[model samples]
Target: MSNLATKKLSGLLLKQLGPHHLSSTSAFHTSISNATAENSKPMITGLFRTFILELRNHSTLSSDELMKPVQTSSHSAQGKSEDQKDQKAISSYWGIAPKKLTKEDGSAWRWNCFMPWDCYKADISIDVKKHHKPSNFMDKFAYWTVQTLKYPTYLFFQRRHVSHVLLLETVAAVPGMVGGMLLHCKSLRRFEHSGGWIKALLEEAENERMHLLTFIEVARPKLYERALIFAVQGMFFNAYFLTYIASPKLAHRIVGYLEEEAVNGYTEFLKDLENGTIENIPAPAIAIDYWCLSPDSTLRDVVTVVRADEAHHRDLNHYASDIQCQGLELKEAPAPLGYH
Candidate 1:
């Protein structure tokens, strides 16, 4: 990391967290001063470990890189100063300082820090037909279980991808939350650390919740659909909770397949939008703000970003399953923190 980028990241840490949370002395902290026997806080660590690396890794970027300069009005000299003030306010809201590094292209310089990977695009159009099929009987069982529960939505909702996403997200968010909670309890009971898996799983749950929120604004589901969400969430929550307790590996594998199906569904949604089967309406404000989409972004753009997010989730859950296959716990490996 460059000296300027390091400084910017350190500043970001100072603003969002107390010194007891993350000291400015190092790129990462192993522990904090707020630790207590009754409520020992877990160490802050994860895939964010690579956040402050050299510029060779261009795919992942910091929050600073997402920032664009506010265009100054050409009518008056005061316009430039006004833009600067407004920029400061925006920066403040994000817990960023006023001192910013700008690139020649008029965008903020990419800093070495942890930020959401919303900008990462995946090659979703790849031919995954072979990969989609089961390789064995056990794989077949998992595949069939997912497909059985999944295909019925098409008959019920038709091409209502927006509402489908809302329902899917509600169920998808459950596993992470359940996993995190169980890990938290396990850590407390065994007096063993989770190696950051707790936080990582919790973050995944929160991310899925945000996806549901964004879709709710876009779809505005009917009352029956809303009722279905409640029924699905309640049943899926308990089912996933037990599944995780019985075999975390199988649970993760299930989610991995679920996310793969989600990616496929979103791709179909994108195709329908492009084919004029679905209206390319303006993106919901929440989606625009959360994904940092352009002002003129439409539903297609939102789906693209959401699909990217689902792809990342699919990778993560499959990786978790792989760890279990190796007779290791998720705590044995680092979890991708801001993986879209």
Candidate 2:
């Protein structure tokens, strides 16, 4: 074919495929079909053979060059470098990259909700039966307040242990959060430290939330029960916030009594489990991990650890109230971090 004729044919083919498809190998076939419709059979045959030769020449280099492994390795390395750059960019954009964690057995950590450092063996030896006797008017009022709240809850749930504890945990989780948030703001406003009280209270809140998560695995709540939680949590959070603002002593005292009630309730739960009134099922995985229980641990073990935790919370809150009652700021005494 003449050089001018070849250039004309190439232009026609490029125009048929459009600029986007010009570089695509598949476009050649479509171009050939279009050309056949426009030209005589003899001219079309010649153009097809010319295009095939051009494609073959462009597709391959010298035999020695095609056999080289270095090219393949270099291309793969370049691709890997680009992928690493993309990953780094994404990580930088987010400003947080998850750390890879392992268990003591060197197995991959399975939970994103909590880290291994958060796991601990519950101090089951803690005295669960310990009670704070109401020594004054405020103490008496706090005790009666908890008692008043406790009875109606008992009447409502009766022996529904899972549902009862689930609701209990939801309420239990709130006070710490409210106390922590208030203390955090107070510390910031005063330009003073919280004597670690903020961290301690937040930790307590997290621990109580973990209890809720553990129970949820055992028994999902019904719609009505969840609705009740919504109403109760909203009321309790606001009421406790105001109480904490008015008097941290009375607020802590109320939480101390509430913890005492929680311990008592768990004791009852254990009794039922022991007597076969409630099935002593294997512990939920979340409970086992959180409490650092044995793989074969049962629900009885879970309740036992939870009861111990309540006992510790009771002591800590009562101690806080005691410090405040003596006209000392909570910051004067170091918080019992990791009390449980």
Candidate 3:
């Protein structure tokens, strides 16, 4: 990856993290209220200052803070921050499932899943329609994962009003995940069937609905009063993800791809449920200047849910394909790729 790409990925990973390790703030009304309540500058002004490249409608964070120095395994094992100490109990309030045994430390869903996530190489990087007769399903599965993470970095950053292109993509994509599922169902009958993969998909879809509400609820004022930019970018992402279903081979890959995502989502949900209530992380110093809520909530929770649902969708797709691909063994094109 280029330096910029590397930095963005780092920021994405770090956005959900805390000031230290165990810790990670609030809605716009809360910030404005706080700002009005105290004309005196915050004690930790630097904490609120923009870090890396600022997106429109928001202040930027420091590159160092944004990138968070990709940690070495040893560093991760030893370096625990002061904030991490306070976060242990607070994390439990979020209700994330499978809380750690320590019981007194922070409980982040991603934190708990770090090891397993590292091991889970959800690679979906193959050209399905063009490769094999009935095409070995394995290649399509791997491709789905890869296609999911790849990004058009520049388009992601392009400016439009207050949002950088990427944030808009996120805002739009959450609703898209649910819509795509509804449209992809085999028969209207399948939608009514509430069992196995269908049941899981519904749960995931509900979560996605919740996620969109959460994003808007957390950041309502700006979106309601100011221009909506990130929301648009999200639409771009939404459309891109949906395009995959057009190709059966590609759809097959996505079905598996989504399953892995669903697994990650549920895994995080388990972490969150165990923890209790997850307090919103503070917006970057820069973002607070304009936007109120942090993007991490939308990014982590929504995407995780979509991924988890996708995981189930993959299963349904596979089952559906079992019969479709029986006789006509056609080579398939690759699946549409992009990170949720």
Question: Cα lDDT of all candidates, in order?
Answer: 0.71, 0.86, 0.38
User: Which parts of model 1 are misplaced by more than 4 Å?
Assistant: 1-137
Q: Model 1, 7-89: lDDT tens per residue? A: 45545755665543332224344323332333331222321342333222334544344343444566456876677776644
Top TM-score prediction, candidate number: 2
Error of 1 at 292 (Å): 1.8
Write candidate 3's Cα lDDT for 192-255 as tens digits.
4322333333433443343343345334434432343444445545554564445444544444
TM-scores of all candidate predictions against the true structure: 0.62, 0.75, 0.28
**Which 10-residue window in model 2 sums to the lowest lDDT?**
19-28
CA RMSD for every model?
Answer: 21.9, 10.0, 28.5
After superposing candidate 3 on the true structure, give the runs of residues whose Cα lies further than 4 Å from its correct spot.
1-138, 141-207, 218-246, 265-311, 327-340
On lDDT, the candidate that comes out on top is 2
Tell how far residue 46 is off in model 3, in angstroms: 85
